[model samples]
Target: MNILQLNFEAGWRGGERQTMLSMLQFREEGHTVHLLCRAGSQIGERARAAGFVVHERKGSGGVIGFLALSGKRYDILHVQTGHMLTWAVLTKLLHRTLVVYSRRVAFRLKGALTRFKYRKTDLVVAISEACANSVQALGIQHVPIIADAVLPVSPNATRSQMLAGQLGIGQRKVVATTSALAADKDPLMLVDAIAALKKRRNDFVFVHFGAGALEPEVRARVAALQLQDTFLFAGYQQNVEALFGLFDVFVMSSREEGLGSSVLDAFSARVPVASTSAGGLKELLADDRGLMSAPGDAGGLARNIGQLLDAPDWLGAMTSKAAEYFERTHRLDTMADAYLVMFEQLLNERRRPRTAAIATAPAATPGIAVESHNQA
Candidate 1:
């Protein structure tokens, strides 16, 4: 199958990582996979470096411009971000190719144009049940759940040691987080949790592995709380996955999340996770897989982190179960295979006679109102 993966994000976030994983897996499975991303984007550069045929556009306008002028078509155009949904729908209208959108956020859909664009897609795959619920609220039915898969990490002891030395993490238990310091991620709450945890114990160092718009506020809180030596902000490393094994525990203080893919990375690395029960995080951390706390509960989050770091036996048991869960449900091949099936199914539907095919317009979901122009 020929596929064109589209992600307009300039940064290398969870969504971009997933997009790269899918392209790699599809190509490995003997399918043609190409990428279309903004010029100089991390994903585009990485894709180009990896020898994939990458089509680079300038920006959102450039994307539409390319679609209008280019005569090439593909078997599938997979939209990997929410902001790119409208362009993907337009491409479908232009080229008659099946558009598959992967909705990775749990934020409620607002605006009539947003709902209309989403409904026009041939398929909308939600990464978690919470995200699926949000999409279904727009009266779009059969939103299949396809959870994000973790790119397997090969432990690099040499790299870990070098990073540890650089970060002054000698013999200190590392409490790490890979969440972007943003509003949804609640970096302020994390700083408060770190402060609360510090009063009880000062042996661990909190190393954050992301950068975002709220960096200044988070930095101010860390300084005000006098966590200068304790809280370390290691902004957005390209191969941050390699450092997960160095962490004793991984904490995510997200106010909302789709599925917390970083938690899956922690599980793969045998690092015990302490995260809030935000959105699909509840589903991932259920069955004693990890320590869970209510969103915004800094005290509870701190306590959970303490337990994970202090109780080695319980941590081992939880990590063992979490690793098993990751192995079973979050493998890269499993997710790639599901996408292949979805692609083939959509292709078959498109090949059917016009009269036999069903309409793509979303059906009205009784009692579930779509709030137009209401931004969440």
Candidate 2:
């Protein structure tokens, strides 16, 4: 399969990481994969370093220009981010290739253009059922759900210890969170939860990974609460998954999430998770796989953190269950294979003759008046 992945994210995040994982898996399986990303973007540089055919464009306008001028063709053009859907739609017009859009967020389609662009997609694959329901709300049927792949973790105890010492988390339990410090992620709430948890115990330190728009507000709140020692900020690291072994518990305080990919990483590392019930997080943490709290409930989150720390036996059993669940359902190969199957099914549909497809269509009842339409 010839695949062209379009991801224009300026920074690396869950969606960008998934895109890279999918590209690497497709390449490993002997498929020809190409990447189209923004110029100077982290994903573009990373893709180029990974030895893929990288096309770096300036912006959305640059993407349109490239689609108009490059004259390249592929078996599939997959839009990995929502913002780049317009460009992908235009690319479909220029190349007439099978267009697939990966919907990774659980945001409802709110605008005319957004709905139109989704309608134009040959296939829309959602990362979770929450995201699929969001797309299906647009009245588009058959939205398939393909969960995000669990990022592979290779733990080095030496590296983990070194990182713990570097972060000043020596000998103390580590409560880690790897998410953007944005409003939707609710980092301020995490600060409050850490403060509340500090009141209960002082043996654990909360280290939050990744940075975003709400950094100043989050810092201000942390300082006001005097959690300088209890709360630590570790800015985004490229191989964050490698250090998951140091985490005693992974916590998320997201107000909304499509799927908490970090929670999956925590599962892979066999670390207990304590996350709020936000969107697809409920799905991942179901069946006592992890501790859960209501969204924005700082008190509840604090209590869950305390439980995860206090009960060692239960914690071990829960982590073991979580690891088994992740291994059974969320491997990188599973996601890549599902995508290949979808790609082949779409290609077959394209290959079927128009007249033959029409002839096979179900006939309307004899007494009913059938509506006729012609549109693409």
lDDT of 2 by residue, 1-376 (tens): 7888989998999999999999999989888899988999999998988999999888778888776565246778888987677887866667676789998889667888888988999999998888999999998998999999966678778988888889898789999899998888999899999999999899999998899999989989999999988899889887889989888889999989999899999999998999999999999999999989999999999999988988667788898899999999999999999998999888777766654756787885589664332111
TM-score of each: 0.92, 0.92
Cα-based RMSD of candidate 1: 8.6
Tens digit per residue, CA lDDT, model 1, 167-214:
998888999999888899999999999999999998999999999999
Please give the range of 10 consecutive residues that has the lowest summed lDDT in model 2. 367-376
Candidates' C-alpha lDDT: 0.88, 0.87
- The TM-score of candidate 2 is 0.92
